[model samples]
Target chain A: MLKINSVGLTISAVPLLNNITIDCPRGSVTALMGPNGAGKTSLLKVISGEHKASQGEVEINRQSREDWKPAEIAQFMAVLPQSSTLEFSFTSEEVVALGRTPHATGTVRDAEIITAALAKVDASYLAQRSFVQLSGGEKQRVQLARVLAQIWDHCECEGDASTDGILLLDEPSAAFDLAHQLMLIEIVQQISARGVTVVMVMHDLNLAAKCADQMVFMNCGHCTAVGTVSELLTPELIKKVFSVDAEVITHPVQGTPMVVV
Target chain B: MKVLNTRLITPRLCGLLLLIALPMVSLLGLMTGPVFISLADILSITLSGNGGNSQEKLIIEIIRLPRVILSLLVGSLLATCGALLQGLFRNPLADPALIGVSAGASVGASLVIVFGSMLTANGLLLGLSAISVGAFAGAIITSVIIFRLATSPQGTSVATMLLAGIAISALAGAATNTLSYLADNDMLRRISLWQMGNLQGASWDRVGLCAVTAGFLGLLIPREARALNAILLGESEARHLGVNVEWLKRRLIIYSALGVAISVAVAGVIAFVGLMVPHVIRLLVGPDHRALLPLSALAGAILLVAADALARVVIPPAELPVGVVTALLGAPFFLWLLVVQRRRT
Candidate 1:
């Protein structure tokens, strides 16, 4: 399980995230749904060890984030930002090979892991293509594959350690098509099924409702609501969390919550 | 696509190959001087510590060896520094000399050569020392100022950093021109020579000092190779990878500046070696600094030695400045690069 304890963050005197705490347990997928400037990305960054909070701590499986070495932290946690700016013309495979940087000792093994990662992301066809030329959605998938590879290489999932890894993604499906978004949700679901804790900052409330077991609604740097999708993703919460009115309904097929924007 | 597995060959093996290749090239450089020593004499001198010919031995060991060794050290330093700067700035065109270290060193060396008659007999040493110290100081000052100016309260952007570098470079150029205008005729000549760059004053002590500084930094930068690789994506992205971007930037700047300062101090300003070697290495191997940094050092050593050798042989006894040789070599290649890049675009 991953725990965020009394987390607070500030950028240039403006508070982006303040005294916010959230948790994602193993075998569960948590979706952070928030309006623009709501500090969802900031929270993800803090969880991934990217930003040092003004005062707070992130504990992964009962160990403080500060206590882990960089490599150790990387092994347990992985993050995927919305967009990536890859300047060089490395092949998709080569870019993914970087995921194994903290793990693999030999180039051959790195190559093998990279190949496996590409396959995992269903991006095997992009293996030979230059990453600089990939489309926005393709790049996100590649990044996801890279982070997944990193997590797979680092996680010590053996023995009674039911907790496997922690994943934090920011708007991963923003550029993705509907099919791709659903695919990504399925991937996150599968990861959770493997006992890896997942936290995703998603904008599409309907998609978030379908996939997330737990939903966190953030507004103005604070988490306003945290509960099961059916319980918390109410029309009132939508209007409050995102300054926009929406109709909340139940999905006829899955009996899950759905938001009509 | 099959990946090239380079792991079987240990780093030690790679080091040994470079070690052997470097000395061989250095020997070749020594042999190709104006007064060439025959293989027999070279062999005899190595076997007996004296070839029974005083002139040949002096030419081989005293004059040629020091120069060859100095070129190797300076080239490696510049290349290593270039790789570091490129990684630090995340710009391939960024070189160690980009921040005015060379210009500052040139001014110092020129001052010594032109004004040393009034100061002391060993004016060259005084001048070189002054220039190196000045260059080191100038480089550090410019980098710090640029870093501070370019970075906003939020974060450091690469584009802003590049613009700042260009602005500072222009400022340094203006200062250099002002010094030249103020210099007397003899001073002007000294300045010109220093600006063109040379290895004629190469000595064991110069090589030793530069080797220590450059080697230490060279080894140090590669340890941060992973961090650099993480940064290639973006600062925000790198941070997400658990990197302390600000700390990495500061450390890289200092290390690269020290490396460039030592090189410029030893050898006037050998331009283009840093830019060319790292670019070429990036082309051959991927942008992975683990491979790029070390390979750039080896390739840079080879290139400078080869260029210095050409400088010696091209005009015979009247040797051309090594800077001119590298420029002649690198400019054409850069042009070709532009053409290829345009075609790709």
Candidate 2:
């Protein structure tokens, strides 16, 4: 499990996260939703150990985040930002192979894993294309392949039941087309089925409602609500937090709460 | 089934071809000069270490050998530095000299040329090579300033790095000009020749120093190839891939500066070897640092040796400064690269 205990973060004397606390269990896909400037990316940065919480602590698998070696943590967890600002022209497959940096290099198994990860995202055709030449959505899917390859072999809980590899994505579907977005949902579902914890920052509420096992609603750097889709995706909460009027009704197909704005 | 169509093959072939080409160029460099030593004489002297006339032997061992070795050594260092900074800044336009290290280093060298003889007479900067020390310090100071300016919360912004380079270059250029104005006739001549860059000053000791430093850098730089590959993906993304981004940045900066510092100290700031060699090599092979770093080093060696050889023959009796040749060649190529980038973007 990933545990955040009253975590507070400040960047340049401006607080971005205030006393944030949450628990993310294994084999779950949690969708983090917030408006712009809602500290979603900052919180993901903190969880990935890219940023530190000034007031409280974060733990992974019951051990403090600080206690884990970077490599040790990396072997089981991966993070993908909305976009990678890579300057060089690495082939898409080469970009995917970098996910294996935390693992090993020059092994046939790594090649298999890389190809398989790209196949999972339907990005196998892009493998030979230059990453720099790819379209924005194509690049995002390539990066998705990278993170998937990072934690692909992490199927077993090392010592704790909650120790399955966790994947944190900041606005993973922000640039994705409808097909890729739906493909991302299926990919996340399959990854979760293999006992991985998935925490994704998502901008589209409908995708969150339809695809996520849980929803986390945030506003002004504070997580306002967190629960199952039915419990949290209420019209009142959406109107209050998102400043939008939406009618919450059961999805005719999946029986989950659907928000119609 | 094997994944034989890996990215590894082309670079491997390129490296092999480069390795095969390097010796031929070096031998060509060894053979050419005013003396017109026969190929057999060059080979026999090179292999046996003692043959031909004593004067020819002296020419081979003391005069020509150090220049050839120095060119290769300095070339590798500068090219590797360029390759590194390109990766660090995540921009193809980010040359090692973009931070004004070369200009600042030249200023340090100019100061040494103007006042160094007096210092030696007074024995003040004792047990030290004044020019190298000054150049190294100047290069390092400029690099550190640019590094500090470029790094921020949003990560190392390209604008800050480029702006700092321009500001520092202008400042250092003015300073060096002032020093040149103040220099005596003899000091002015030294400053002028040194500023243009000369390989005629090559010595065994300087060759040894560069050899060791360049070897260390050549071996050590490839180790960071994996981290550099990720760093090319940006700092945060590299970190997400488990690279220690801060540590990687520090190592790359220090080593690149060290490489440039030594090259400048030895070679009076040869322009564009760092910028041109890596870019040309990158275009040919690809931008994978594992390939870029080592191939850049080899290609750099080839370019400098070839340039030095041409420097000897182009104006036979009196050698044109190697820096002028590199700049004359590099400036146009660099402009062409910019044009190509502009079109692509």
Candidate 3:
């Protein structure tokens, strides 16, 4: 389990996150929702050790984050930012291979796991193509492959009952087409099935309704609501958080609560 | 199935081969002096405690050997430093001279040549050493300034970095020109020729110093190839990959500066070897530093040797400076690279 205990973060005297306390329990897809200036990305970055909380402790599996080495933490958690700019031309396979740097011991088995990660993301066809030449959506999939590679052989846990690994993503499907967005949601669901906690910053409330079991809403660095999608994503909450006029109606197909104009 | 199966040639194996081959080539260079010495005579003078012919011994043992050895050492050092700088900046266009190191050394050497001869005899060598020391200091200072300016929360800005290098280089060039204008005729001729670059001043002491420093740096850089490769993705990404990004950058800067300073100290500003050699090697072999670093060193050695040979034979006894040959070769190659890139688009 990943636990944030009274986490407070400030950037240049401006409070980005204030007294935020939450838990991303194992085997749950938690959707983090907030307005544009909300502290969603900052909170995710704190969990990934990209930024340090000002006055709180982040613990993973009962151990404080400070106690774990960076590589050791990487072995247990994988993070994908909203976007990245690559400086050189690397093949899709090579880009995925970089994810194995923490585990690569010049062994053949490591290569095999990398291959499997590429296959899982349906990016095997792009293995020979340069990442620099790929479209934005294709590049995001390759980056997803890289994150998958990081958690491929993680054996510390088996199901929701166990808590050890976490996957944090910032707007992973923001630019993806419908097919790729669904594919990513499926990937996250599969990862959560294997006992990894899935926490992500998402803009599309409907995808969150479809994929997330739990949702956390933030407005101006403050947690507005936290609960199951059906309980938390009501019309009033949507109006208050996103300032959008929407009706919270049950989906015709899946019966999940979805927001629609 | 192996993706890159051409050959898993380790950098260590390449280093070992170079260790054996470079000396043998140096020996060959020594034997091919103005006066021909028989193989037996060469062997006897080297092994036995007798100079069978004093004139032959002086020609073989003294004149040609140092020049040949210094050329190889300086060539390897400059090339290796070039590869490190390219890796550090994650830009193929970067070189050791990007920070005004060459101009700095030229300015220092010119200062002593212009004034020290009137004050004391044999001030030329002292001036050259002073120039080298000054170059080393100037390189470190300029590189630090540029590094600080280009690094920010947004990460490294490549365009800003190149612009900073160009600005600093222009300033150094202005200072170098000011010194050049003050130099007298003989001092002017000698300093100008040195600035163009030469290996004709090679001697045993210079060769020994350059070789040791070059060998250390050449071996040091390949060991950090993994870190260099990690940095290709960006500093923050590299840190995510478990690399100590700041430490790696500092180490690369210091190591490359040492090697480049030694090269400039011995030979004057030889251009394009550092810039062109690494780029060509990166194109042929992918950006995997494990392959690019050592290969760049060898390609650099081969290029310098070929350039030096042409320098010797181009105009006979009045030898052209080797730097001219590298620039002549490099400019066309760069133009062709641009053309090919445009055609592909």
Candidate 4:
């Protein structure tokens, strides 16, 4: 479980994230949704230990975020940021192999895990291709493979064993095609079902509604609402936060709440 | 889709081939002076301690050997710094000379020479004549300052680093010029020769010192190969991958700066070898630092030894400042690269 309590982050007197308290239970998917510059990414950075809070703190599995060394925090939490800027021509296999950096493990097993991750994302074909040559959607999938490979052992889920880890993704589906987007959702669900937490910052409300177990909506660095999809998917709330007319309707196909704007 | 894993094989092969080629190239450098010394003569003289013609043996062992060895060490150190800096900055144009480290080190060495001369005229100075300490301090201070100036909340901006590097390079140049201005004609000539960068300052003791420094830094920098690879993914991503970004940056900055400083102290600001050698190597082997760093070292050594050999034979009697030959060789290649890059864009 990941918990944030009164975390406020300031960069030279400008509050990027303010007094944000939230909770992510184990084996669940929590999607952060908000308008642009709403601090969703900042909040995610704080939780991922990339940004330090000027006030308050984050606790993972009841462990203080500050107390945990970088390697320890990285052992469980994997973050995939928006819009990769990979400048080198490293092969997709090499990029995915970087996931095992934190684990003091042998390459033979790590290579197997990388292959599995690429296969899971349907990126097995791109494994030998250079990362710079991959298309946008392909790069996203490869990065997803990297994040997946970070916690591959947890996802292996031995008999009666509850696997543990957390995945933090920022706009993972931003440039993905329809098939890859669905593949991403399916893979994420598979990961959560294995008992790892998935905290994703997503822009697609309908997709988030269908996929996430809980929702946290932010506006101007403040958490305006935090609850299940049904509780947070009100038209008035979306209108007030997003400044757009939105209609909330139940999906007849999946029997879940959907937001149309 | 089924490509063989060449990244693993390429480095090993490049290293092995270079290891084989290095001694031959060094032997060529040993052979290429005004007085002809064949490989056979070199081997005989080296093994028996007295076989070759007496004058040729003196030239080989007493004069040329230390100079050639010093060239190899300085070249390797400079090129390694260049590769490390490029990796650290993530910019192909990032060279220690352009980024003020060499100029900064030159300033420190110059200050010592000028002020130490004053103190020694009255016999006030002792045990501090060597340029290494001064050069190392200067390089460290300049890198720290430039790094601080360029990094902020927006993260380390490449544009800012480049601009700051230019500004710091200018400042260090001015400081070095001021030191030269205060010196007499004799000291000024010494300063100019040092500034021109040469292997004439070579001695067995200096060669030993440089070899140890190179080996030490060479071992440690390549160990960060994996971390450096992750860093290319971006700072935040690298941090997420458990690479201590701040720590890595600090460590590389200090190590590369020292690497450049030591070389500059010995070779006296040889330019373009650091800048151009890595570019050439990257074109051949690509930019994986695991390969790039070690390969750049060997390439740097080979390039300088060859250039130094050319310097010896260029005029037949007087030696050319090796730095000049490198500039003449590198400038056109650099321009061609820029042209190609622009055309591609």
Candidate 5:
């Protein structure tokens, strides 16, 4: 379980995140939804230990984030940035193998995990290609595979009920095509089903409705609403949050809320 | 499996080729000098200490051997430092010289050259001459300033450091030129020659200093190869991957400064070996530092030894400075690499 206790962030005397609190339980997918400059990424950074919260603290698996060593936390917590600045000509497999740095699971086991992770994102064919040569969508998939490989073995123990890992992503679907986005949603579902806690910043409302178990809506650094898709996808709430007039209706096939603007 | 094997084979093969080429090039350096020594004679002298004639033995032991060893050590240090800096900055064009360390060292050496007569004693700290100590101090100070300028609570900015480095290099260059202007005729000649970077003054003492620096780098750097590789993915990304990015940056800057300082102090400023060797090695083997670091070191050793030998033989009676030779060879090759990379992009 990951808990954010009234977290706040102020950078250079300017407030970026207000007293935001949320709970992300095991086997759950939580989507952070907000407009531009809404503190979604800031909140994600605080949870990942990239930025420290000025007012409150974050707890992962019942331990304060400060108490855990970086190497220890990295074994179970994997983060994917929105984009990468990796300019070197490392092959895709080599880039993915970097995710295995925190574990002592020898080269053979790491290779197996890398291959499995790549296949999960449908990027196995690009394993031998250079990362710099890949298209933006392909690179995003490879990066996803890398983060997956970081926590690949965490979800193997089946009997335990506690959370095995936490995956943090910032705009993971921003560079993906329609098909890859769907594939990513499936991968997130599969990983969460294996008892991994996932927190992601997403833009597409209908897509978030399709995959997310809970949604947290934010505006101007404040989290305004937290509920399930059926409860929070009202047209009035959409107008107040996104400032656009949208009609929320039930999906014909999935019976979930669909927002049409 | 096929792809993996192919990726794995290239580095191994390149490593083996470099290993083979190192000894051959060292032998070539040993054989070609003012007095040409034949291969058999050189081999016999090296293997059996007392085998050759006394003059040949003296020439080999006193003059050529130390020079060869110094070139190897200095070359390896330069290239390895280049690889480390490039990895740290995440810029392919980043070189040790690009960061003002070399220019700073030049200013330090120039200071000693112009003002040495005033110091009553030529103080030796850790077996290094006063000039070397000055150069090392200058390099360290410059790097510290550049690092401080680029780093804040937000983290180090690679672009800021690059710009700061250029500014510092210009400042150091101006200092060096002013010293040159004030230098007398004899002092002026010494400063100019040192600036050109020659191995003609190679001694057992200089060789020992370089050997120690190279050994220190060899032991410390390879351990950080994985961290260096992680850094190429960006600082925050590496931090997420469990690397302490701040610590890694500090350690890399210190190592590069030390390596470049010592090289400049001992052999003046030899350019392009640092920039060219690592790049070529990266091209041959992929950018995996586990392969790039050691291969770059070997290739650097080979390039310098060969270049030093050519510097000796290129001019019949008078020898050209090894720095001139390296710059002449490296500048065009670097331009070619730029063109090729541009075309590809």
Candidate 6:
């Protein structure tokens, strides 16, 4: 489990995140939902330790974040940034293989994990292609596979109660097509089922409702609401947070809440 | 399961090819100098280790051999430093000169050439020429200043370091120009010749210095090959992958600065070998540092040896600067590469 204790972020005398606190349980999917510039990505960065919070601290499994070494933290946590600046001529497989850097797993096992991770994101065919030449959606999928490979083994060791993996994604599916989006939802659900905690910043309310078990609504650097889909998917909450009039209805087959604007 | 077939020439094969090419090119370098020692004579002298003071034996052992070895070591050092700097900056165009090593070394050498006589009476210090010591110190000081300028509580910022490097290079260039403006005719010629980068001054002492620096870099750099590969994925991503980004950056900057400073001290400012050799190797093997680093070193040695040989024979009894030859050869090839890449895209 991850705990964000009144974490606040200020850069250059400007407030980016204001006294935000949220508890992410083990084996649960938490979606950070908000409009543009709501500090969703900023909060995710604080949890990932990219940015030092101006106030308070983050704790993972009762251990202060400062106590963990970089290599030890990397063994269980993976982050996917919104965009990558990797312009070198690395093959897709090589890029994904970078995720195995922290592990001492031999080459043979690492290669197998890379292939499986690529397949999980439906990017197996792009394994040998040049990463720089890939389409935007293809690039996103490759990066997703990279993060997945980082924690691939941790997800499968279900009986090991001490090792819990965390995946933080920043708009991971923004460039994805509909099919890819659904595939990503399925992948998130599958990983969460295997005891990997997933936190993602999402703009699509219905999609977040479909995949995330817990939703945290953010507005203007503040967390407005936190609950299950049914509890927080009301029209008033949607209008208040997103500044848009929307109707919430139950999905016909899945019975989950869907937002209609 | 499919054998990771991506590159045109696999790194292993490219390495093997370069390994074979190195000695052959070195032999050619030995054979191509002004006196034109025959292969048979060169081999006998090399094999026997003494030829009873024959003129051919003396030339082969004393003059050409040391020059050839010096070129190989300097070339390998420059190219390896280039590859490391490029990886550290995560920019393809990054070269050792970006950190002001060449410009600062030039300024240092020029200072010694102009004022050394007044200070030392004889331009020697600790067995090294005062100029070499000055060049090495200048390079180290400039790099350290730039590193400090870019470091703060937030860690070393690559962008800030880049900007600082440019500013320092400009300042060094101005200093060297001022020295040249103040120099007498004899000292002016010496400064110009040093900047052009010649192998005519090759000696056993300089060769030994280059070899030790090359060996040191060879041992230290490859240990960070995997870390460099991870770094090509942005700094934060590299940190997320368990790389100690700050430690890696600091080590890379120090190693490359030392390698380049020693090279400039020994061989003057050899230009294109550092900037071009690594790029050529990267095109052939991709940017995986594990392969790119070693192959760049080999390719650099081969290119510089061949260029030094051509510098010897291009004009009878007179020699061109080896740096001039590298630029003359490298610039066109680099342009052609750009054209070819454009077409492919």
Q: In candidate 6, what are the lDDT values of residues A20-130, reduced to their tens digit?
A: 889999989999999899999999988888899899899987898878888999999999999999989899999999999999999999999999999989989889888
lDDT (Cα, tens digit) per residue for candidate 3, span B110-202? 766676565434344432455555545555666677667777874556557678777877877787788778877887887788778877767
**What tier of docking accuracy does candidate 4 attain?**
medium
Whole-model lDDT, model 2: 0.82
Tens digit of per-residue lDDT, candidate 1, span B1-345: 443322223445655777778867777787787887776777788678886489888877777777887888888888888887887767788886665566556555555554555553434453355555555565566767777877786566657867777787787777677778888887777677767778887877787787778768766777898888878877766665667787888787778767776777667788899888887667545577887788888978977897898899898789899999988977787678656554643
lDDT of 5 by residue, B30-105 (tens): 9898899888888899998876688888889998999999999999999999999999889877899877898888
> By DockQ, is 2 or 6 better?
6
Where does model 1 exceed 4 Å of error?
A: A55-59, A63-69, A104-112, A153-163, A243-245, B1-28, B36-53, B110-164, B239-247, B337-345
**Residue A28 miss distance in model 1 (angstroms):** 2.5
DockQ of 2: 0.52
TM-score winner, 1 or 5: 5
Q: Candidates' DockQ values? A: 0.35, 0.52, 0.36, 0.52, 0.58, 0.62
lDDT of 2 by residue, A28-144 (tens): 888889899998888998999988788899989899988987777888899998888886778889999999988874679899989998998888888887787788998999999
lDDT of all predictions, in order shown?
A: 0.76, 0.82, 0.75, 0.83, 0.88, 0.89
What is the DockQ (computed on Cα atoms) for candidate 1? 0.35
- For candidate 4, list the clashing residue pairs, or say none: none
Clash count for candidate 5 is 0
Using lDDT, rank the candidates from best to worst.
6, 5, 4, 2, 1, 3
Shift of residue B138 alpha carbon in model 5, Å: 1.6
Task: Name the candidate, 4 or 6, with the larger TM-score value.
Answer: 6
**Ranking of all predicted structures according to DockQ, beginning with the best and ending with the worst:** 6, 5, 2, 4, 3, 1
Clashing pairs in 2: none
TM-score of 1: 0.86
For model 6 the interface RMSD, in Å, equals 3.1
Regions of candidate 4 where Cα sits further than 4 Å from its true position = A158-163, B1-9, B109-137, B147-163, B178-192, B329-345
Model 4 per-residue lDDT at A42: 93
DockQ of 5: 0.58
Residue A30's lDDT within candidate 3 is: 92
